[model samples]
Target: MKVKEVTFSYNQTVEQLKAVSLAVEEGKITTIIGPNGCGKSTLLELMSGHYTPKKGQILLDGKAIQQHSPKELAKRLAVVHQKNDVPFDINVERLVAYGRMPYKRFLHSPSEEDEKWIDWALSITNLQTKRKKKVEELSGGERQRVWIAMALAQKTPILFLDEPTTYLDLYYQFELLELIKKLNREYNMTIVMVLHDMNQAVRYSDWMIVMKNGQVIARGVPEDVITGERIEEIYGVKAIVDYREDSGVYVVPIGPCQRDE
Candidate 1:
């Protein structure tokens, strides 16, 4: 996926994103990070075709995104937001089945192929036990997984997740991110996500974009892009990064900084 010279604004004249541009490589994870009120989410929305770009274009495999029909786009891309509100009456299995809608025609029911995908999605998200359970009955982490399962059922090659780990507890956070890593490695699903947890973003992403006030301040491998100076510049605080010869990549927040004083 590519966002080329994209610009966007709110209901009025204030600009949300400037002439921003970035490319997400196929079959890898790219994480975006920035201070609050920056245009990180807006960029994702544009790349996902949820919003139109006033200045430029988004492309999938060199084809313009809007050039494709809704179904065509849905077959290639899926989005999972930070929060999803589901009807209390809808069961988890039914929720995940919705991902197959793009592949269905009016008056047509799911085929055996659709069932296969839905079943696989539920199993991957570990919602098989709760397949019959209402989304409202689950914990925050479980509900988030349900949303992910829905996206997985879409069977898209790319996924967009906006701060997916925000409210999840420690176990669920690791569990969910690990699941995402496995998907990238196993299925080769390209991923783009916004994350506030720099450590997790660095640990999980192959490349990262650090934004400050709606512009790409820096971007590269985590080791090069997430330095103490860059952290202080973008996040407005100091950070420490150290090399563990065993790990190779720089590990961040390994020590306390003077900013904590």
Candidate 2:
């Protein structure tokens, strides 16, 4: 997907995205990282067609994204928001089966094909055992996996996640990230996510887009874009950018620093 000079506002006066532009490299994991309220989630929403840009356009495969129907878009792109609230108590399997709605016909039950995808999604997310359990009964990490399983069942080529690690402890956080990396490597899926963890972004992402205020400050490979200076610039914190022989770039923030007014 390509965004060109995109600008968006929420209340007509508070612009959330200002002339932002970036191209998501296909078949790779690209992460957007910045301080809170830096428009990271807004950018992801725009790309997923949740919000139309006030200016500029978004293109999928060189075609305008707005031109596609809702179902058409769902077939090509699946999005998992920061929070998912199911109005009623829904089991994991039923929740995952919802992802196949785009391909299902009205009044028709899930076909064998839909079941196959749903089963695969549950297996990949390790929620197969919890398939019959209520989503609300699961723990935070398990619920997050259920949401991901639903998205996986969509069988879209592109997936968007907004702060997917929120509310999870350190161990579950790593587990989810590993699952994401596995999905990308195995299926060649194009993944875009908004992440607040700088080190996690650098470690798992192939490309990083750093935004502040309403604009993109920098975007490139993690090794090139994530630096001590850049982290301090964007996050108003002191940090060290380190590299290990086996692992890639990692960041350590020491403390906060004064930002230019």
lDDT of 2: 0.93
| TM-scores, each model vs. reference | 0.93, 0.98
Candidate 1 per-residue lDDT over residues 113-204, each given as its tens digit:
99999999999989999999988889988999999999999999999999999898989999999999989999999999999888788789
Name the regions of candidate 1 deviating beyond 4 angstroms: 245-261
After superposing candidate 2 on the true structure, give the runs of residues whose Cα lies further than 4 Å from its correct spot: 259-261
Residue 51, candidate 1: alpha-carbon lDDT: 86
Pairs that clash in candidate 2: none
Per-residue CA lDDT of candidate 2, range 1-261, in tens? 999999999987799999999999999999999889999998999899989989999999898899999999999999999988974888999999999999999999899999999999999999989999998899999999999999999999999999999999999999999999999999999999999898889889999999999999999999999989998888888998899988878888899997668
CA shift at 142, candidate 2, in angstroms?
0.6
All-Cα superposition RMSD per candidate: 2.6, 1.1
